[model samples]
Target: MCSNVIRRMNEQQLIDGCKRNDRLAQKELYDKYSRKMMGVCMRYVNDRETARDILQEGFVKLFTNVDSYLQEGPFEAWMRKVFVNSALEYLRKMDILKEAVSLDQAPEASSSFHSVLTELSAQELLTMVQELPAGFRTVFNLFAIEGYSHKEIGEMLGITESTSRSQYTRARQLLQKRIGKIL
Candidate 1:
């Protein structure tokens, strides 16, 4: 409990220093959050190189908009929002997000689709998500993982709510199939 307070104080100091444009604080902040944020980026993007680019761009946005922070919530949450938005923006620019759903793919197998997923580790799950098609992956991460509603994801990705739902369904089916193969 004592360490929690110290860590909170340290985080506050880092936020304050970053708000003032302190270079050391900025570096420290980047060093602290880069790896986790890169994981977030990688969930949306396929390759580490693209994820790194998104991470860098997200940090730039985070620092530039530091003055707008109001301490209404945890700084880490705000930073995460920034990184997620950056990744979505990058996906949009690359024209990788498709709203159209493919009807040709096989129908979902069964409700036990995700049962096999529990056997795999987090890193294995991440790898599985990375293997998904871009549209399905984005919807999956946003809805299934990040807890975003279909409406919110639709708005974020500039697609209809139905499209988001369809993509998410398709993503789950594909994951189920893949995990079955592994098991």
Candidate 2:
């Protein structure tokens, strides 16, 4: 199909075309989703270069594994999930998943995050999140920013739900401490 024709196609058809190895179709898909998917990748990875790397690899999976996508939801949203999972997987492979300071292992959760959060803008929050060590940071992003439940975060990172909760607590604690320092 022509580039214009490819661009006009809805995502499922674009995905269907990609499964058939249609170059124009895949390019169209990439052009459509890459920006938003990059945002998602950046949230998880917290580094532009690494997030871009994840975005490229995630797109590779999108093209190579297009057949695995279910016809269950919006295609862009599906692709977002794929890229999100892939970003998480990249963190896991890098051995960053186990750093969650278990609540039991961490000092008690403080009300510090709440005290300081209102003063920060969205970008400020993102920066604070980026400053967290990997385990605490990833869980915080998934649960707090991305809206994943503790159970989902646990499953994705291979930790318990309580661990996810505790890690989230610790992440907030760290954010509080760091932001407190900045103010």
**Clash totals for all models, in order?**
0, 0
Candidate 2: C-alpha lDDT: 0.80
> Which tens-of-lDDT digit does each residue in 54-115 have in candidate 1?
99999999998998889999888889889999999998899878744466764566667455
Looking at model 1, residue 138 earns an lDDT score of 91
Model 2, position 9: C-alpha lDDT score: 85
Pairs clashing within candidate 2:
none
TM-score of each: 0.90, 0.80
Candidates' C-alpha lDDT: 0.86, 0.80
TM-score of 1: 0.90
Model 2's C-alpha root-mean-square deviation from the true structure amounts to: 3.6
lDDT string, candidate 2, 1-183, tens digits: 696764578866787889999998888888887888887777776689998999999999889988887777877767877887898889879987776454454554455456567777877877777778788888888888778999998888888999898788788777766776777
Model 1 per-residue lDDT at 110: 61
